[model samples]
Target chain A: MKIIVLVKYVPDIEAGYQFNSARRLDRGGDGLLNQLDEYPLEQARRLAEQFGAEVVALTLGPDEAEEAVRRALQMGADSGVHVCDAAVEGSDALATALILAAAIRRLGGADLILCGAGSADATTSLIPVQLAARLQIPALTGAASLTVQDGAVEIRRDLDAWSLQLAAPLPALVSVNDKTGEPAYPSAKAVMLARKKPVESLDLADIGVDPAAVGAGGAKVEVASITPAPARAGGQILDSESDDVVAAFVALLQANALI
Target chain B: MSDILTLLDDPAREAERLAFAGAIGRPVGVRLAGGPELAARPGTVAAALATLAVERDAAAVLLPQGLFGAEVAALLALRLGAAAITDVVAIDPDLTATKPIMAGTAFSRARVTGGLAIFTVQPGLEAPPLAEPAEVVELAPPAAAAGEDRVAVLGLTPRAASGGRPDLLSAEIIVSAGRGTGGDLGPVEQLADALGAAVGASRAAVDAGWVDPSLQVGQTGKTVSPRLYVAAGISGAIQHQAGMRGAGLIVAVNEDPEAPIFEIADLGIVGDLGEVLPAAAAAVRAL
Candidate 1:
């Protein structure tokens, strides 16, 4: 059995960020594997161990994004693939999914494709479904728990009001959320050995993607404008440390008619 | 300004979409109500919508912003070669959309350069200026949707209602807790109950198994905008702020004075949640 987990390199949200003149994220900053992507990587590693599956980690980004694939290898992936090209920059979710679909096909597909519920930077949660659509496969996304057996993949999803149990045949896509489980930390030995894993790099042409169909040229949507979110002026902080504090808080709620 | 179509899984959520479509100022030629059967099958729904959009000359397709709505919109847009954006908070007459990005730390105004535009309207918009009632159309699954046949639903169980608490999305008041709760939500629940508010949790609390993942609020979790949002024990990371910063009023209680949550809070109280939350509940009950 073979499993491919899609991972991404995102700017550390805590480290902060800035937008370029084109209103794109400045990727020349400190970056790491998106926290959410770890969940699927961990799940893929577990499945490889259980079923003797070949686990491959895949990512799409600029030259530096190979770091994300290397990180995945350290976490137990057998190998890594990086789809890196200048033309892939500034591509929206639609184009990104299209390129990923092409890359997956180029790799000869898999028994199961796994990924995070969403990328931390985009947080649109669009790629998994879009990729599934492009691939013409069933997508069981936002899975809290997932298991593969009997040539099918099943997952448990906890929605706002329902807990759904969904299943799809092999060669399907599954996007797992943080609830799946905590990712295991790579050992120091694994980190050193990860450098030995073969990392294949592909550009848009290699993936059969037209340069004009992606990046700024193929972007279906354009950022009209961007601005810092208007800051909220914080109110007074009551530090009385007494009963009066509770009274004050309640009174303020009443004054605002929030209760 | 051109033809628009809307697909809502729940009729109960129609008002918000109506208001959103009204904001776009276009004729909604059709409103597809995604009942149980259709809502359960997004691939089928997307295939049907793909045909419907072309047939109706729909320039835009709107749906409720949530997990289901996002799925259908993405699939439909891909099939139609259209542009899709999710969790949109506002739309201008010219089709420019305003949405939070980078975990609500910033806002992006974007527009589809060409072709149809698909959007999922977030909840909590005002009622439509004039209700434009359109015929509710039910579509039969298209043959192309047969591709979805590979998937099956094994079971679905509705979560037991939480003590009649309002849903976190639609609740007017929400009391959320975080790491400081020490995995004990009793105080948070009490405060929420006293105020008739919904219960919420930050990622820390959810990660620590103090609360259900469904109740989590953050960039990766559910976004909420209640009239009153109370954060207790949460230090307020940027991800957490992205989910709740839109609330009309924010009251934060944390032991740390330098917690990032206090920076955006409308009301900041420096104290322990265990003592402050219970006391606040008692005070609210007396009211």
Candidate 2:
């Protein structure tokens, strides 16, 4: 079996991020592999090891995106694919999905595709399903736990009240939540080995995607304007030197009739 | 032609979506997917929405916001060649939209300039009911997307959570635990049960493996806006606040007086949540 893990190089969410004139993220700042994407990468590696599947990490972004794929290779992926094009910048979720689906098709398909539930920066949680849509595949997203066996994939999805066990045949897409567990860090040897691994870069034309249909120019939606959120206005704060603070808190809830 | 076609998957958001339509004063046609049972696939939902939007000649389509809903809205927008925006907080009569982006650090006001637009409205936006009922159109779902049959549900079991966790999106009050819980959520769950509130957890607690990641309320987790958000042992980081700042009222209990959670909380109590949550739960039970 062969597996493709969708990874993204996102702006360092911990850093204070700012937007560019285009009202999109100013990726010029410090960037790193999206934290959530790590789960998919690690999980795919585990699955690959179990089934002796070839794991490929695919990333979409500008030049810096190759770093995401490199990290995946260090963590045990066999190869890497990066969809890097000037036209992909500022692309909405749909456009990103189109590009990825095109790239996936170009790769001749795979038995399974894994991705994080959502990105740490955009946090839109859109691309996973959209990619599945474009690929004409079934997507089991937000799966808390997943396993593969007998050409079938089973996932346990937490629906707040119930845990649902869903099974999907091979060649399906599954978006994994963080509960898939912590990602494995690469050893020095693994990191060095990743340097010699194969990395392929493709542009819009290479993937047969129309240049006019993506990027900021082709984006379907436009941000008319953006403004920074206001500073948090400090609410009433009371010290807890005594238990009276609890009484005050209770009283406040009472005053608001929330109690 | 109707002005808006809002997709509702959960009945809990019916009144809210209707009120939003009324607030915007736009004609709204509804496509309510089965509740609790989200359509097996987002592609099916997208197909249904595309058919509805085209059949009704709606200038815009609305979706109740969530992970899956936003994805379908985007796909439908692409399929229909329309504008699609997610995390929409408000839409004015003039068709202007308000949505948060960049992890809630920024707000954008946009108006779809094209012939058709799709917007995903955030939850908890409600107003008085419309004078007339919203238009409900029956939809025959299109054929499933290719390979959709590959995905099958094998079983469902009630997740054995101690609190019988309420649906966070619909819960009126949310009792959330943070790192201050020291990895134990018993008191938090007890407090939530006592208040009949859903139990939510900060990313710290979830990452620490103390709580399920699904219960995480943060920029990277589920966004929510409830009538009351009781944050226990939470330091009120910006990411955490990004998800819950819209709550009608916020109460924070933490040992540190300088915790950021207090800055946005309507009421603040500086103490151990292990003690405060239990006491507060007991008080609520008494009340």
- What TM-score does each of the candidates earn? 0.94, 0.89
lDDT of 2: 0.79
DockQ: which candidate is best?
A: 1
Top-scoring candidate (lDDT): 1
Task: Score residue A212 of candidate 2 by CA lDDT.
Answer: 87
On TM-score, the leading prediction is: 1
Cα lDDT of model 2 by residue, A1-259, tens digit: 9999998888875577778877777776788887778888888988978989999899888788888888889988999999888777878777888899999999998999999877766577777777886787788887778899998888887775567788888889999987778888899999999999999999889999998888888776677888876655667776666556656766766787776
Per-residue lDDT tens digits of candidate 1, residues B108-208?
99998888888887877675554556545666545536556777778878865666788888899999989988888999999999999999999999888
Model 1: how far residue B13 lies from native, Å: 1.5
lDDT of 2 at A117: 75
Residue A48's lDDT within candidate 1 is 84
lDDT of 1 by residue, A7-93 (tens): 999887778888899999987678898878899999998998899999999999988788889999999999999999888889988
> Chain A structural similarity (TM-score) per candidate?
0.94, 0.90
